[model samples]
Target chain A: MGKNKKITDYDMEQLIGQVLRYGVLTSGIIAIIGGVWYLIQSGAGFPNYTSFSGEPARYTSLTGIIKGLTEGSAKEIIQLGVVILIATPILRIVFSLFSFILEKDRLYIVITLIVLLIILFSMFGGLKV
Target chain B: MNILLFTLILLLGAYLAGLAGSLTGLGGGVVIIPLLTLGFHVDIRYAIGAALVASIATSSGSASAYVKEGITNVRLGMFLEIATTAGAVIGAILAIYTPVNLVAILFGVMLIFSAAMTLRKKHEDALQEGSKLSYVLKLNGSYPTKEGEISYKLKNIGGGFSIMTIAGVLSGLLGIGSGALKVLAMDTAMRVPFRVSTTTSNFMVGVTAAASAVVYLQRGYIDPGIAFPVIIGVLAGAFTGSKLLMRINVKSLKVIFSIAITLIALNMIYNGINHKF
Candidate 1:
């Protein structure tokens, strides 16, 4: 509504862009580090992916991933990188929600909330197949 | 092959897949799946999981650039994301229950459809007046052009939102970005400007993919070994390809890539029929 508010909106958009760029760059670096460590530590083993067997329990959940990281498992480190990548967009949504709140735009605040909630449900709702 | 050899080869293949994906605007996931399944003999489920990670990388990476350019309508993207995220959750669940063979068949079909879309000429239909619903939602926005700023109005919010749901389902089930379908929903159904439709679709894809990716991760499908090389390779390739896009004549390149993708799709169909997956 005011000139000051408009400047904040532009600043928020720039901030969102910065978040995406940095999030992706940071995650890529982590994944690469884990990958290099894995290759160096156990490069001789052969990989057999001809069939579908799900990942081990340790690599499947968020808590398990963090636990593996503390134990110095390279694969879990890579998974942690992936967790960061997935989190990037969710963070973007969080920033957008904040911007909407700043603008006092009730409709977009509600719309952004719906989108964020759906994503949260997919992450934590534990709907089994 | 040993893990070192395998990882190296996969890295190379994924780079090309990402390069060709961004160059053709068809996305890396489409080619990444077939390359993993038919070429490396990897299981389709693993392929899908790796592809999903690559999709998230490319979408988020590029969205950073597009958002700064100010062409992306964040508000419009957020509004449509309500449908997409819900649909993605449903599609990810369906993928878990569906037969692998059927999933391969559907993925092949989607690849063919995507190739066709790339070959078709785009028609920008920016409307002059916003619909009553669009007005209330404040969906109308302006973008910068050569001639100062040009504003556009939106129409058929319901129809566009419906198509976006389908796009989300395809993205979730197949582990693809499904940008073509999202563009169609906005550009054709919603009558958004082509520039806005594309940039906004790019902006929305990361979130949409993230929605389903969470489900995939919980089901233990995201193998870190496969995902590491794929993500690194695709992100690098896409970054290079986007830079090249400004200099190269992409018209001819698109035709060639589409043909190549079509052949790969047909092969996937054959393999699915024979239960070779």
Candidate 2:
């Protein structure tokens, strides 16, 4: 019974657009943070670029820089991979779901759900061959 | 090589690639492969894995919007996917066993071909309807052009299907979106109107990517450290690009992109041939 705001302000497309932008930005931020974290945690020596893979190079090389970043305890790296594996897809599916809702179309929703289920089961079902 | 840092560099690389690829209309995967393998010295296999994830993100984020706008022919996309996915699965298997050198050489050749093709005449400006298969499949559809809705039918269903199969294989083998090949199949071989073919191709790319992505993930080739950044960055960039598409001349940009891809592919070939361990 009071003053009414314009309906245009609450448009669904605007909301969807916000979600799209936010989701993408957040994911990018996470990726950058993860990369930096890996570098500091690895504590590998500063690298040199000259030497290719061999027994060992005496001096720091360019590969050494990248190697320093890559050579970490397997457990820690694997753990990070697992976390990202779960996080990335879930975000994607969530965004995609929102899109389906925005469109108000039921066309591929079932198929998407089933495809997602397969991916989830395959990833986490713990069925090792 | 710490895992986290590897992920970080890959994220940066992908972000750079996405922004650049969008500006150039080359597609993210094309730029990412060279950046990872040549610029950062990442293993080619891992680079391809990351590229595959990025390709899906790029297509999914951008193409979904097009679908919402009702420009994409979803039915056409679904129908063609059966052939593409089958081709993708076979191609993925081949990628795992094919010698790295062969992959490199093939990639190089493709890059050259794509560059030349891009420089060729713009087919959208010259539309010719020829084949009967397009009519049988109802590949003909109308799209919103500036002048209004323009309806066009397909001409060559068989030829188009064959091209889709090849596109799927290339996508699986190289972790690319394979949009160039897809467009060529529809625009040149099938004579489907340009807009319809491109959007439909975009619609199907996600399916193609998923088919091969599953295989790659199972093979342990998909490192999350690499995939996460790529997926995120590319999705964001592609989303932005889709919005800009209505305002830009994507065709002109595509020519430049093709050239860049050629150079990147050449670099990959050189590296693969030289990296004899």
lDDT of every model, 2 decimals: 0.87, 0.59
Largest DockQ belongs to which candidate?
A: 1
User: lDDT by residue for model 1 over A20-118, one digit each (tens)?
Assistant: 999988898999999999888885656678978888878888889999999999999999999999999999999999999989999999999999999
- CAPRI docking class of candidate 1: high
Candidate 1 structure quality by residue, lDDT tens digits, B1-277: 7888888988998888777777776677887898889988999989988888888887887778778878888899999999889889989988968888888998888888888888776656567898999999889988888878888899999999999999999899999989889888888788898789878987888899999999888887899889899888988887887788779998998888888888998999898989988
Q: What range of 10 consecutive residues in model 2 chain B has the weakest lDDT sum?
A: B122-131
TM-score of each: 0.97, 0.70
The Cα RMSD across the true interface for model 2 is 9.0
Off by over 4 Å in 1: A2-6
**TM-score for model 1?**
0.97
